[model samples]
Target: MRTLRRSRSRPWPLGEPTSPDGQISTVDLLLVRAALHAGATPGQAVTALHDRGGVLDTTARRIAAGEDLPALALDPACPGGPLVRALAVAEVAGAAAGPVLDGLVDGVVRAAELDRLVRTRSAQARLVARMLTTLPVVGAVGIAVFDTGARTFLTGPGGLVLVVVAGLLVVVASWWMRHLVASVGRAVRDVDPLVVAMRRIGRPAPGSVGVPPTPGEGLPTVEALELLAVSLAAGMPLVEAMGLVARLGPPAVRGQLRRAADGLRAGLPPFEAFPEGLAEAADVIDISRRWGAPAVASLRLLADDLGRRAAAASEAAAEQLSVRLVFPTTLLLVPAFGLLVVVPLVVSAFSGFRLGP
Candidate 1:
């Protein structure tokens, strides 16, 4: 396995670390993935990763000493982090190391991209917020200094009400705009890559039908599909492939898949036996069967498509945020500043004069 060069001053990579804690880096995980692809067992992979040592050394030593890496991953106190967790999930599915590790790499890359998108959007929103806040302060200061009637207005009942209303508007508009931007971030966070992949699956081939995906079941559809593709690539029969994926998959989806598997056992065709909402998946499998094309290749293409779409969507949301900001500025902030700041200064400037006299 290739090890990254470590300097005495900075043992880690120069760029942003994957985790908030500086201990484990994405580079380390990529190295592990490479080792796994090259036929190293999980334990062996970690042990080799240890020599490039930092925070990983302790965890690697344990695995090297005959500890089960996947089991260690399940223990929260263990040093094994997300990489181990991904490995554990793959191990449970009895998936080939290749596809599992490949998926892990892709997942980490996608997550990093999403984080950057979110951070950029948040920074832009904060900048706008700062500028909006500055408006009221600057207006108030200028009015106080330049307008002699400011005192008269400041002492009046109407002026007091205007000031109070303006304050409330500024505060409320700021809060509302912040909430809107935060909600977008939360939505982006809640978007599961697996679910995204499944949603982007091409429509069922013409003249074919499959059951709609189980409502509220929220099963891991892409994981199931990827596992199925892996099995098929390994030359397993379709029935056995479905059975294996169903058996080792997550408990939530196990029963759903088992029902499908049972249907297959009873000699039902792929379109019927595959779980609900898997019509496109069935079609892909059927195509693979006919032309000897690799279903996993199609899966890889789908994953790439999902990443592109997600990135594009997030970018659009950020751009739309800038446009939406105009609403609160015009309706709340601008009116409040005019009432509380401009009106007082203008009225106060003529307070000493009596026109009817």
Candidate 2:
């Protein structure tokens, strides 16, 4: 067996060899199928399969030699099933190239991971999202300042001095602005009410309507329903209540609520009028109808849960922001401010002392 293994270890005539153990798992075959379906050459598919620890040398040779590989190798229950689906979709979309499909698959995986992580600790996710959103703007401003300073310095003696001062000013301003933006973004993303509401309403469910809230958007389900409930309790009609909620909620949620409200105005019952995307939250609507409870009541409970989550997220974000702020303020801003204010004075004092000497 060891001699056979060593012989198999020798590079095969056609391509890489497979293991002798016949241990080629279903996931390995699915990956090969996905790769081939995505337009990979058999050689490339084999390489990828090998990279993923799917198959080995002697076994690959046997399969290449037209030996019967297990029929179970392509089972949909394999871990690579989703990858195959994505590959098939890419092929149908005319985007079956390795890099493109790979990126697509990667993005899907990332989104799933992010969703899990965000659901687990929504506040941190919001904070991170906010920071990512603001990064480009902050970087642009830095580049602009650097360009301006370089231009100024190229001009002459006065220009050089001005360049230095302006460059320093821009740097200081950029640092301060970055710190402020980060803090504000963190605060906004971590808003207690919004986070809580999102957690309540954005949970994975069968009939849930709409995507989750963006970083800066106010909490959706909570804020919308709260507004609607208040309107309803104040003697407003359901259509009017919905209009009010749409006007008050985040743009995306507002659009959905507006549609729901329009359906209601067209004579749809309250339970029937709930948005399509919120199929996951059907139980809430069901409870509302079966118990003869106000439709807004069930939604309100969801909102309240979200609001509490948002609050916790906000507090955590605020604490993180405070800690982050300390570094730039003391190390960067304070020193730069001291230079801007005290440097000239010190320079003048030294000049006066030299003249007297």
Leading candidate by lDDT: 1
Candidate 1 Cα outliers beyond 4 Å, as residue runs = 1-24, 34-40, 43-82, 93-99, 106-126, 141-157, 183-279, 289-294
> Cα lDDT for residue 113, model 2?
40
Total clashing pairs in model 1? 3
lDDT of each structure? 0.58, 0.43
lDDT, candidate 1, 1-357, per-residue tens = 000111011211211111233335567777877788788876677777776766567778888787776566534334534345445445544556655666655665665566577557656665776688568757876777777577568658987888888889988887767755654433432343433333455443221223322211112454456556566656677787777656644333455567677788999877787765466676776787699776767854553454455456656666567677788888899998898787887787667678874
Indicate the worst ten consecutive residues by lDDT in candidate 1. Answer: 1-10
Total clashing residue pairs per candidate? 3, 29
Q: How close to the true structure is residue 302 of candidate 1, measured as C-alpha lDDT?
A: 53
Per-candidate TM-score against the hidden true structure: 0.61, 0.33
Q: Tens digits of per-residue lDDT for model 2 on 240-319?
A: 76665554434335456666777778987655776654443445656766887766556556655554555455445444
